[model samples]
Target: MPGVADGQGLGPVLTVPNLISFTRLLGVPLFLYLFLATDATGWAIAVLAVGGLSDWVDGFAARRLKQVSRLGELLDPLADRLYILATLIALTVKDVVPWWFTIALLGREAVMVLCLVVLRILGHGPPPVHYVGKTATAILLMGFPMMLLARFSEAARPWALPSGWALLWWGIVLYWVAAVLYFIQAGIHVRAGRAAAAGAS
Candidate 1:
């Protein structure tokens, strides 16, 4: 979906897009249960597929239906993060991906959290999601399922393993790049805010 201008009034909450986002969020626990408790790799993959598809669908529905909301904005990214976290945990537990891989991705998220906190304390909201961040997220989402397939499906291993790693590495690099960009933007905002305060004082 195209980016709507900031401060465009957040539309209604009970919308098609929000419903789709909520459904995607609901799949997270089911995915975790399937992958970890039951070892249902195939079913887990299916759930992931649905979650990914719904991710796009929600954004499209928001734009097409003119139903974008603050809640939907919050829910959409929250669902994405939860799914990524859930997948990382499951993969790490299965030893499909190295612990360092998880740590690196998680570290970027930690930096992002710090940026958000600093900005919030300075009386600013988070910066808009960068395109690089969105691209990195989409790549990681694609890569995770391919990795699961590579581990479980002998036939897919040849293609999936190499491609999955490539995507994962690329995603990680871009994810940090986006984080740095966000951090820089946050610094600028903080300085401006403080300057305004000092001038007033």
Candidate 2:
């Protein structure tokens, strides 16, 4: 079918959204290098800005252009996670964020992964992207670059550092809340799956 894929989401593989996602995925490593290796502030900011902009662009294109796909849905979150991972790694190496913070963030993601595996075993699909989760991601993404600027540029320290730290912590708290919501979502799906199976039998 031209319009469906394995009874999942959209069908196309080469969608503008998917391509943008792949590009963002690739940009993760490049962003890491620029931030951690070269410390090229201008280029790093450019890449981060473009990547952030592309995030919005891809989603809009997916809906307006009708190019959404299962691959895209998967890639989009994966890219967001990679970006978060990359930011965490680079900042953690730089001692920009505390170890506990990293652990907390990664821990939530790890639990989500486990929950997803359980859902799959129960023949359910991935959790829907919650608005809370998206807001958390956006806050963190925006905060990271500001934190970098705060670390690297003395001129921007007074404002950027405070704002960045504020946003970052807010994002972290809300992210955990989103994680809790996802767990509830998983539980609902699990019960539904079990009920469906029992009915069928």
In model 2, the runs with Cα more than 4 Å from the true position are: 1-10
Per-residue lDDT tens digits for candidate 2, residues 49-79, read 6776566677888888887787888888888
TM-score of every prediction relative to native: 0.88, 0.90
Judge candidate 1 at residue 188 and give its lDDT.
80
Candidate 1: where are CA atoms >4 Å away?
1-11, 192-201
Reference-based TM-score, model 1: 0.88
Which window of 10 residues has the lowest lDDT sum in candidate 1? 1-10
lDDT of 1 by residue, 1-201 (tens): 333434656556567788798889899999999998996889998898778666678888888877778878788888989988888988999998999999999998898888788777768987767778877887888888889999999999999999999989998999899889888877887788889999999
How many steric overlaps are in each model, in order?
Answer: 0, 0
C-alpha RMSD in Å of predicted model 1 compared with the true structure: 3.9
How displaced is residue 91 in candidate 2, in Å? 0.8
